[model samples]
Target: MATLDGNLVSADDLLPLALTNLGHFTSMRVDADGSIRGLALHMERLVKDCKAVWGADLDTGRIREYVRQGLDGQSAPCVVRVTVYDPKVDMGHPADADEPHVMVSVRGAGAMPPQPLRAMSIPYERDLPEVKHVGLFGVLHARRAAQLAGFDDALFVGRDGHVSEGGTWNVGFVDESGTVVWPQAPVLPGVTMALLQQHAEHRIATVTVEQAKGMTAAFATNTSIGVRVITAIDETELPDDHPVLSQLRETYLSIPGETL
Candidate 1:
């Protein structure tokens, strides 16, 4: 079951519409005790995106209440998605300012798959890379092509061959000096990446496809999979486990979660 603005609604009600077609959302895992990491950052993301996408202010305090309502007393770990959209907005004039409501949905959380990913580089990029918008056809299309090509997923490469991010995750590399290097390209600043950056010393650098192969280690970060080391990029093989990677995982795990 999903809660749309404090009211229980069928999941079917989340279909695309001309007005509600545009959406800003965040996905995170809630522990068995209902604690979450970087809770304030998640709320800040919603507030900022809501202002940019809808030109309306969002009450994050009430939004938290709605999220709790969606959890509905469940004590087990679950994946939570919080989406903000306006189903009743006028579609004829999408530019007009309108209020958007929150949609909180919960589901059973799955453990991250253990296998390292064999990624293939694809020339593509996301529009409005800063916002976590619901426009994902580009990513899905690229992912499908990669799977068909015998790759686990697609790593987006700019026209200049600079590595950016994965279809649904943020990509980072560790240098020989144990520095966390983020690709200095246009990409979505994900919640998990934000959490890691806040607690770790990282640098932003422009990484070419060839330069990535020379890095000591590479990893992908997303809400669904907290962190996973990349095994290979295109044809260059990378280590699945390294001392730096283990330290990165430890750093991420050490960040205390907030009580939801």
Candidate 2:
């Protein structure tokens, strides 16, 4: 994917659309097993979001057809992304209007990283806090900072001093009581997190950074990475032999054809 005017551009004509102006959008990944995964849920949310922001008659059927045609002949185990921008206005409105624009791209699958990742805290905020969008400068910045700090990614600390999420994944933590907690704010509704919620015998809560320290184990979830255990956070390291993370890793690997 290419960047034009700070937005992800797959074709020249899509350059002018503001992906964030729409009420709802989705960023989904199609794995090698030919599974669409959370595409339906993403689309459902997109409709609700688009309706809230742009009003009715957003024509989601048009968007779905666009995705189907765009990905008709792609290989298995590839990554696909579709963005719906401002659908309520044309060129006259602000650049961030919600006229929807669909974009698609694919990349070859790669092996997963073995070592557990570490994360550091950083600042971020979601404008809508409901639907996904194409603006990711904060994620890019956090990833760069994580690389410089010798880690895989960064955990966003929202203005309310709560743990929001990782650059591209939803955050999870196993508290000292052996309970799992996932905060609802400052995070996108992740498909992988939904899967984990279904699979794990755990609980969920709107957690805080101070409460995060009481966690004995931490991890993140995304379609690409599945479930990734967090070994360290800001110099606080969990034991390599921690059983909770080990079990989560094992459960993750048990999924058929889920390898990175």
Candidate 3:
């Protein structure tokens, strides 16, 4: 089971449940090889974001301890979620009486696709870009737009008309020099970004427009997807047999659950 609100699930609980309009946020299919991979980093960011956005005093150490206790040696694929929203409004209660609803859940692991993905760009931005909030209506809409365009996922363009990142993942590309270039603009700092940087032969900070125009290859990053190589961006066709993308895909699959 997964940890939620500093507590663990006991198999009697169910998900897809919500009480307030604060919305919901989730992460699933965590690799179960006894290695937390990037759990600590993710928890750190979550705590920081929560405090900054919600004035919540979340303890990262306690959160990790809950996860460790709940993990309890079950090595199957696991799903975990932490959501904050309004539970119920207390009529006539003080305005500050609203409690922030939160929960964590985990389940056995599942399969993750390893194929290189093709993506199209969408125009959207998060109202609170700093916090990874449960509110994801814009992201859902963008994903729907990608589906309409015959793509599996969507890349997001910011207000400045520059490529920011994916609606649900971060973007990285290989320049002509074979250096891995990624954006450092108002984008979410992803745990996968750190992993890729450690593994890449070369890494640099760059924007999406520069990458779309001249990148030799590209990919999306996230804990859920790990790394999804981009086969095409907009209408520009990259060579189907690009070696750089192929190598990244192969290397990515070597990680337990993320396989093609």
Candidate 4:
């Protein structure tokens, strides 16, 4: 299901987004009971990105209503993506656009793959590493190149050789001592990563690709896939089922979710 400002979306309403593609969005997994993990962080991210991209203030209450309307009283867990854009905005004159509108799209929830992912590190960086904007050409291109090269996903490493993040998720490492280590780099502050940081004993540091390979274990975190093991980076193989990493995944999922 899809909704624009709490109403069923029409093709005409999406022309601007399709044409100009100037927007920011946030996706969250909504449980059967209409609750979400890190719900506040998701909402906060939307508001922050909205302001950063369009200099507009978004009403979180209205966003929640639009999302609820998109859910349409469904009783199954699903993935809900709330996109902020202005249909009135045209590619030629985006600066004159009005306040952004909320587009809520719903789909069936997804789970982590049964097998651990193998990622290849690529030297890439997003336009605005902090905001989760809609500019995904580079991200998708990198992922495609990695897949063609016989890899599951792409892990972004900066030109300076510091590992930043994954294609659509935050990458974290488990040291030999069982401590979680997050790379200190310019990347999107993922809600799932934030939640994990609150509950897991972790530290942040600048981690290069070489250093990451030496780590005992690694994992990826995102809203859809709460925590997924990363078994290999480039040609270096790591443990797929570290006990600490497994415990971290269980801990993240066991946390209570909040109502939309």
Candidate 5:
């Protein structure tokens, strides 16, 4: 039902990595015909993060094969997650493993949330902000805490109150004049955000949580949710309907997908 390096494996085998949490991963969705959005960028991300974390060369071809095997005979428009890590070595030194391997899991895609997100800011930042890694203790805790406190998700803010990103998505705002403004801070270079920039007009600026209140509209980006509206960040309510966001959604959807 799942694939580990192109071979069938039980989910139980992955439990071992939970102990070390020394892994990097990328999760993406496959279209009805098994095509992925920004496939090349996704592959590039896997190789780059793997090399950075493990000092090992990860094969994109092998990863593609693994993805194919995982998707075959399964539902179309599915979700695929590829994790790279080493199971051996202590000190959780996965870099010493003979070679880093990827575990690919394919499952039915989830329906996008119907409601817009409401986020509360937390004064925290991720370690190794560039890599899409599996170390999620701090991030997850923040999200949970926010959810329990009455917000939909948590937004990460620096000590200066400058917003960085969301627990799982990249945050973007539209200024009063209809320009896309991405907060200037350390954030994972998300594949969705990367694809969007190629198709939309956006600029980066240093914006604090206090400054976001002045924005006309806001949205969050990720593979799963594409470009989703964020109704509020803390107590700042942004417009739910705006020409900039509508144009952004259309531009993002227009990008043709690539086969793995």
Candidate 6:
């Protein structure tokens, strides 16, 4: 189900986004009680991205209202995505657009696959690494190429040959010393990653592909998956069941969700 600006959305309301695909969004898993983990982070992301993408200010309270209206008091766990875009804005004159409208879409919750993921590192970088924008063509293309190459997903490597992130997720590594290491590169600051960092002892450093390969284990973090072990990158194999990775996942899931 979907709503636009707290009202039921129609096809006309989505035409601009479908055509231009210029917007930013944040996804979250909402419990049956309308609560979500890192809810404030998500709101901050939306507000920040709105300013970056459209130079507009967004109210978190209004976003919460729209989300609740979209959920419609359903007592079932689901995934919710709030998209901010302006239907009246065309690519030719985006700067002339007014405050962006919000679109709240709800769907059934999802979990990571039981099997560990194998990723292929590719030289690619998102246009705006900071915003969770609707520009996903490059991301999906990379993922598809990795899948065709017998891998689960694509791990993005910047031009500098430093490992940055995975398709639709942030990547974390566990070194031989059991230290959690996050790549110090330009990538989306994912909510799940932020939540894990708050509770996990971690350090940020520039991790090249070779450095990542030397790590004992790796994992992917996103709103939908929370945390999932990455068993391999390129030809290098990592421990799928590393105790440190398990502890990090547990620490992430243990975070309490805030009520909407």
Per-residue accuracy of model 1 over 39-103 as CA lDDT, tens digit each: 88888999998988888999988988998888887655788999988776556766753778788
What would the per-residue lDDT of candidate 4 be over residues 1-260, giving only the tens digit for each residue?
68899888999999889888799999998876778999999999999998898998999999988887888776567889999998999788888886899999988876543368899999999999999988899999999999999999999999889999999999999998999999999999999999999999999999999999999999999988889999999999999878988888888988899986
Global Cα RMSD, each model = 1.9, 4.9, 4.8, 1.2, 1.6, 1.3
Local error of candidate 3 at residue 71 (angstroms): 4.0
TM-score sort, best first: 4, 6, 5, 1, 2, 3
lDDT of 3 by residue, 155-230 (tens): 8888777787888788888778777777766777777776666566765564656457578877887766666668
lDDT of 5: 0.85
Model 2, runs deviating above 4 Å: 1-11, 18-24, 56-64, 86-92, 95-99, 112-115, 246-260
Q: In every candidate, how many clashes are there?
A: 0, 14, 5, 0, 0, 0
Q: Per-residue lDDT tens digits of candidate 5, residues 8-60? A: 76656576577778789998978777788889999999989977887878779
Using TM-score as the yardstick, the better of models 3 and 6 is: 6
Error of 6 at 79 (Å): 0.7
C-alpha TM-score for every candidate: 0.93, 0.77, 0.77, 0.97, 0.95, 0.96
* Sliding window of 10 residues with minimal summed lDDT for model 3: 11-20
Instruction: Give the per-residue lDDT digits (tens) of candidate 2, residues 60-178.
Output: 57665665555567776566555545434455565445345445455554444345778887777766555575556667888899889888788888888888888888888887877
The total of clashing pairs for model 3 equals 5
The worst-scoring run of ten residues by lDDT in candidate 2 lies at 1-10
**Model 3 off-target regions past 4 Å?**
1-19, 23-29, 69-75, 84-102, 107-113, 198-213, 239-243, 246-260
lDDT of 4 at 193: 98
TM-score of 6: 0.96
Error of 5 at 216 (Å): 0.5
Clashing pairs in 6: none
**Per-residue lDDT of 52-165 in model 6, one digit per residue for the tens?**
998989999999989888888655678999999998988799788867999999888865433678999999999989999999999999999999999999999999999999
Query: What is the RMSD, in Å, between candidate 4 and the native fold over all Cα?
Result: 1.2
